[model samples]
Target chain A: MNLRIIKSGVLDTVQDQGRYGWQHIGINASGAMDRFSAELANALVGNDSAQPVLEMHFPAASLFFEQPSLIAICGANFSAVLNGEPVPCYQPILVNKYSILQFERLNQGARAYLAIEGGMNIGKWLNSYSTHLKAGAGGHAGRPLSTDDEIRLNSSVDWQSYLERNEFRVLPWRASDFWEKEPVDEIYILPGREFSGLTELSQLSLTGKTFTLTPQSDRMGYRLLGDPLEMQNREEMISTAVTFGTIQLLPNGQLTILMADHQTTGGYPRIAHVISAHHSRLAQLSPAEKLRFRITDYSMAEVLYRRQQQHLHQIRYACQLKLEWFIHAGH
Target chain B: MSLTIPYHIFPLGDSAMTVDFGSRISPELNSAVMKLYHELQLTPLPGMVEAVPAYSSLSVHYDLLYCSRHRPAEQTVFEWMGELLDKRLRKLDYEEIIPSREVVVPVCYDISLAPDLEMLARERNLSVEEVIHLHQAAPYRVYLLGFLPGFTYLGETDERIAMPRKMQPSPVVAGSVGIAGRQTGIYSLSSPGGWNIIGRTPLKLFDKDREPLTLLKPGDIIKFVSISKDEFEDH
Candidate 1:
């Protein structure tokens, strides 16, 4: 099965979990920025959690289906139209051959995931299909999809049978079911290496004051506008390793949260790292959305992380049972 | 040789740790970094996903789940990392090391790209030619790649070329070469920068088309070669 890109989105690319093991070679782990959504999209379509899926940013992509297949849309609910019909998201849908799927505009949030039953067929480097655009590696020629690009699928199953057997609407699964949502205006953060170096007032302001996301935001980072944070001392710390969710303070006292596709190392004094538990909230935050930081300790972050993992494990078991019953019915 | 190693280990974040070989930049630390880097690559601990070696430290990324599963009796993964670092440095220094490959980068000192070359020369109390000569005189090593993707942070420029960054950063053109403090580098992509602009190269430092796209890597040595505008454009 092949998908022909009629119109490319702002920045759409095929991505899986990510490429690890090669950070020693100076490669950052570039993958789906909101990996949880990517996994859920795959799971909804009876694909493995690790399967590669299309990551679309800001919609506007149009594609033509070459064959009948099972698919699902997860993440930001962009306005998607299938053959001029509005298609529901977060569930499996069966589309016949010659169907045209057009993602017009992003009505909410930034990124959305499109997962086929099996997965996207792409050449792998270092054991992943995720593209590291900076290093020019992985995915389709190691870059974002362009107009007229054709993407092939690995699945050869008879997915058309789903049309007669199951409802086309999404099953009862929402990100909120497995992970809790953060306050609309508050972003949860864990104090980081330079947390103690901030002036007492700056420290207090970090948790109390609200900041608005600037337009200068992308997969690389989120720049914020707010009261400038002051450092206790003016010492310039040596540059070191930086990661996604790392909140770095600039010379002008502005804050920038490094996101997916961020550099592997940085020199700025990091004030905090958004806890993984709240990363989805950060992911869905739109430009100009006001957000406040709430400081949490390490212990709480760890406990929250483990609890989320357990919920994910339970979801996986439930999906396995659903698939087993479907197959046994035909037998 | 007596095997006594002194290093500092610190928290990079909750999930990872960094072992710094020294407090300041020096050749010893660079060697220590490479030595420890190779050793870790040869024998990575359980759950360790990556070991990123920089000018003075190595950052290790590991899977917390696997690390806990294989947790040793003596310490947590963080403590075990510290102990392993000590053992790694205790061995005899791996002398007769692999020589860093030299990459000659062609740069154009033309009027358009180096718009501030005259101003920079006046601040440094030197002629433009002298500035270019000093920049090309020494072979610099790649210290790390950061601040942006494919942006190479190089080490050890001739001290005569040591200068503070531009007080007000001009919009840096892509491929512009500049010096800040004692380090020198070329801008791989156009972004806001304060480095002293001396010249520009035509080579695409961060093109997505090339395999292993970046020409420079840590432990690699580079020398800037002055070229005519035509020569620069041809490459």
Candidate 2:
């Protein structure tokens, strides 16, 4: 069982919840930018959330399925299509062998995940399937998918009988956007240790003004564009550990929100951090997208996080039940 | 004799906290961080994912969700963590110690290998031989590992050879020995750096195949031994 890339996307790679417990050696956990969708994709297919998924950007890869299999396309609505027929996003589908899958239009969001019944047949580096772009290890060949890259599937399902004559069959159940009610423009953040060290104007601007993410952004971080933020005093600081969502003020007076592939440590002054709950939504925002910072406390951040996790937990349970029922009822 | 270290714990983010000893890069401050670091390795906080030790601070990364659910009803996760660290500190001074590794690395100080050696020597009004002698003279402490994997920050170089970082970054090769301010370090991998390159080491600082992953770790004491050009390639 395999999937061959007919055409590659702008940026596509394998990622999971990321590699952890290696920061001591300076190796960071470079996982899915939007973990909620990654997990949702897995849940839809009855696969564990920790399994690796194919993360793709707009102009996503066009692939040909080599075997009948179960799959789910979650996150950014890319107007996914199978054999020229529109397939709904967020729903599991039974894909027949030789079926050509393509993304026709960019509906919304920045990244999308493709989850099969099992997972990507790729080597794990440092106990993670997530691709470390800089180190050139993990994932499929430790690089972006290009034309002719064939990825064998770890799928265990016998879907040939279920597919029958249909090239693809979209399952009835689907997931609603978990962040539907949240405002996209306001990204909640918690002040960092050096928050007070920033000059008063810079501090005010953080919440008062809107900043646009620049094209310079990638897995490393999202560089923001707005009025230059200044510090009260110029100080030589030692490098220290920083994590995903840490907003560091550069010497150039700009701010960068560290993302999935952020190095384990940094020398820049950390000014703020996006709450964990908002990371999924924030990661989906493409370059040129604007957002304002909203300072929040740890307690509120904790509340938001638990709610998000709880919703995901419900989805996983409902999905497992649906998948089990579907499997029992013969096609 | 062991000294009682004073420190303050600050919130790094919602999911992590850092214990900071006031900023002065002395072994005294770093020893406290290493002591805490080694202790955490042996006995980590309940929800801690990992702990990162730096120049004068230790960042404790934890699972916020896990901590919240596991903590006592009255204390918030942060408050509980603070209390946990407080208890750890109150129980002991630095007298109880974990043995640290002492490593000796060889560097080739040939003119071809040392890009900034001639310039650095000229700036300090010293000979090239004097520059290498000063750099390799004292045993330096590995205070932190950051910037890049295995790209260590060894500190308190001989005052005569200690120089500030270059105004602009220079593309340095793997194992490039460099100096910036009072600190000396080696570029574990090929990357652009601002430090003055004084020599090059043949040893691999980082190798995934290696069990330890990095050649150096925080709290290790290190020395640089000068070697010949032919000796560099032979390694």
Instruction: Using TM-score, give the best candidate's number.
Output: 2
RMSD of each: 3.5, 1.8
Chain A TM-scores of all predicted models: 0.92, 0.97
Off by over 4 Å in 1: A24-26, A79-81, A84-87, A102-108, A135-137, A165-186, A327-331, B1-5, B72-113, B148-150, B167-175, B188-193, B200-214, B223-235
Over the stretch B32-110, how does candidate 2's per-residue lDDT look in tens digits? 8888888888899999988988888888988988998888888777888888987887765687666789999999999
- TM-score result, candidate 2: 0.96
lDDT digits (tens) for residues A1-331 of candidate 1: 6988988878888888778865644568888888777877787767878888988888557888887777888778788878878886776667776788888767776778898876877888768899877666788888999999999877777655655643233334433422235454577787777889999999999998999999998878999999999998977666678777899999899999988888777778889988766666688777898898988765566556566566666656676677557646632
Instruction: For residues A165-277, write the lDDT of model 2, one tens digit per residue.
Output: 88888888888875477787789999998999998988999999999999988888999999999999989888777989999999899999999988788888999989988
Give the Å error, residue B116, model 1. Answer: 3.6
Best by lDDT: 2
Give the proportion of true interface contacts each model preserves, from 0 to 1: 0.27, 0.56
**Superposition-based RMSD of candidate 2 using all C-alpha atoms, in angstroms:** 1.8
Name every residue pair that clashes in candidate 2: none
How many Å off is the CA of A166 in candidate 1?
9.7
